[model samples]
Target: MPDSSAVHFTNAFDIRSVGCSGDPTMFEAFWRETGDAAELVIPGWQTMSYFSDVGNVCWFMEPLFDQQVRRLHRTVGNAAVDGYHVLVGTGSTQLFMAALYALSPADADQPTSVVSTAPYYSSYPAVTDFLRSGLFRWAGDANSFVGDSYIELVCSPNNPDGAIRDAVLSSGAGKAVHDLAYYWPQYTPITRRADHDIMLFTVSKSTGHAGTRIGWALVKDREVARRMTKFVELNTIGVSKDSQLRAAKVLGAVSDGYDVGGGGASRHRLFDFGRRKMVERWRMLREAAAASGAFSLPAETSGQCNFANETAANNPAFAWLRCDREDVEDCAGFLRGHKILTRSGNQFGADPRYVRVSMLDRDDAYDIFISRLASLK
Candidate 1:
């Protein structure tokens, strides 16, 4: 595997790719540093029981998982973990839907309107409407939403655009669920301790371990947590014990790196590693976008990072690119015609001139994307 630096490769897939969780191979060095310590040699009989422990509601969560989550939180000073119930899910997606279910009134006259600002995560509307559940339905932007009862899905820094955001609808009946998958120190500053009512995070974006299929939510309301937990129980009974264990080990390993003061050969801090890689990638992207006169990128966003002890800008998980040239009607289609695939801005409730390009591909593929984007007329 190549270093964390995006490896340069030649292929159709290389140019076609420009999207999420990143290539895990980038973490080859970091994982190898953990060595056999992360290895869990579970005997056949060990996991036969459904319970991971005696007192836990669901038995799959090892105590270490919760502890490490708190440890990492305190270490990074990103989001609050204390006074909150941490519920695990297959990924943030399950929790996202679960929050909507939990927030919507079951006995209401109609399903609660779920909404977010435009250029939102494309998946929000798709997932909410796909099941066509009676509990809640996908409502467009919160800005224009006139309803009194609603669940506002707030993604900060917002996906597709990476803009830091707050709940737009201030109605008394409105409740907000914060999708904080990209709120880590690597992508954005440890701005303030996020202590929202319901905040969702994923291991995928945090550590580039998207395949683990593990995510967690921090909920303040016990009843809300109970309902969300019930939703998971009905959806899949519970999350994967194996995956949770692996995630615990991975997260613990990440914490250990930072705990050791981040230096020398062994203590390679995960956040530091991730932040550096992202900043460099963003620099390359900006240059590429600048070279291409037909395209425009979002203005850089920076703030004082408490973790890094320096001012840092957001190097978001994805790049929101706008086609500035008059010739391009649908930016995504234009890129696709040029052998590149991107999520169109319209999917996020924006115009056809906008496109979301993933910044998580391996270095080689990213290099190709930048080159192709720069050369595109």
Candidate 2:
């Protein structure tokens, strides 16, 4: 609960930290500043039932959570919700698996091929093949993948690299699942309302409530949504109702902060606070990368953000840092030797010279990381 604004670091760097995981602890300060806006209280007797809205395809999904999901989309103009079926999951990870299960053919002679562009999210391969399911198999990068039947994952403002992306394969026989977890105004500009067939999002990335363990998907087809819901049913019976309610409260609070009539617009807004923090962090990171002179980051990119009503830069949740030192072949190993833990780009189907650094750690850890990175020779 340390306020990021209050933490300061000197020339001396004493802290060594792990920022390999995209844990969004940076937004803790903003929620704390909001006081009781996002606070939730449920009666002990409530949420005891295993069923919620049995009429819906995702029977366990809370209606309030569903409503807030649409409302938030409308408020931010980040994704198209109209005519989309809102499906809930434990987190975006569960929904991601659901997309694979829902998209894969049951009668295929071979396991359906799943793919993404190079330098993709590392979890895309790990999670796809973890169960060793015969229904689908990870088929490496989409750029090199050659097949008619496939499921391509398009992560916009993609993880690890933050590149705005689209489906690499346009085969009519292939289905694409858009992972827009970081499409919020904080990470990238809302250039247009995303209307992909299957779009996955989570409270973890949007509101930095990773512990809430709640994610919702917007599916255009009823049958696909039904199949995705079945995947959730088979995976965990159903997601936690308490978590759904809590997520609903948090999302509602976010939309409320932007309500013009509610007068909450004058108060601290989540996206505003988030965007400010990310912009500042990206600036610091750029400065550090320059000072080190041994690393290079993606060039800054910006677009007119429909939500923020201004041009915004792509401030990804992770930094795709490439080591420029000719002697260093493995950037991750070099950083690890310096007591900085990061995921190597090789895991993302990219070069070993590059590493993905999490930009969402706590303020103290982030400051120490920036200092250490700047001092790296």
Candidate 3:
């Protein structure tokens, strides 16, 4: 098999409409080279039952799925799972809501305030208030929020800006849910093993399997796990067992590539492939920004990645581009006029001069985007 890490970029660019929804389809090439390492073929007769484990709090969680989740975490050294209870969700979005439901007080007179730092995940506020649930309400930026009771979302390598973050609110009454979705070595360096009270992760970001719609949460408290499980039970009954099994196979395959006893000669290491692509893409983006002269990007940051055992740059999944041109106040609009779609910074509670561009699109779309961006004066 050809080395998945070595990708060839052609000068040929296709001028087509691009949609940047954090869809991670770039990893398709890498997975394609892995043969059947991540493939799954589940018989129809299997996974027919609604129940997976009745004795466990998360009764719907398949054992193999649970095992693979922990195994991959252990192999990557990105999260601590020794004492955590893993709860599966339809997606991390469901688990995120579950965290809000589990953390908020049921007897409180007012809705629990949910806040994250400005330039937070656009979905956090939208998802929190969509139901208008009395349990929790979107409370804007955590930096300005003055409350004793709140659930703070700490998305490290934050969605819009990709900054390493922690809970902004430090009140004793405030609880934190760490969204470590992009903590994988590909996007950012694994500086430490994350050990938070409630942590959210998804196959979408981690393994680039967004179609699977599989996400899981690690809860330090059994009661919290039970409540989160209850939220999933009420919301979706249970996550799809087929998706879970496929996710398990994918995750296990990832671990296999690194295991000394298993597939030692395997050329399917996902992180190696991912890091190479991200680094190259970031280099291209920086060059584009420099060539444009009207655009700027966050200074590249680097750290000692424990997983890679070397200092590595934080090549974020999203490029937070700022249009410095005096006439352009809305970067998204400016990019939209150029046929390069991106999420506006205003939606992330920041200045309109900035926009969040997905760095994980297919080669043709990304090539077109960078080319268009570079041509802008």
- The candidate that achieves the highest lDDT relative to the unseen native structure: 2
Off by over 4 Å in 2: 1-16, 262-266
lDDT of each: 0.82, 0.92, 0.91
Distance from true position, residue 246, model 3, in Å? 0.3
What's the TM-score of each model vs. the native? 0.92, 0.95, 0.95
Q: Once model 1 is optimally superposed onto the true structure by TM-score, how far is the C-alpha of residue 133 displaced, in angstroms? A: 0.7
Candidate 2 global Cα RMSD: 4.1
Report the lDDT tens digits of candidate 2 across residue range 46-91: 9999899999988889899999999999999999999999999999
- Candidate order (lDDT): 2, 3, 1
Per-residue lDDT tens digits for candidate 1, residues 133-249, read 988999899888997999999999989799999999888988999999989988999889899999998888888788889899888998998888889878987888888888888
The residue pairs found clashing in candidate 2 are none
Model 1 worst lDDT window (10 residues): 19-28
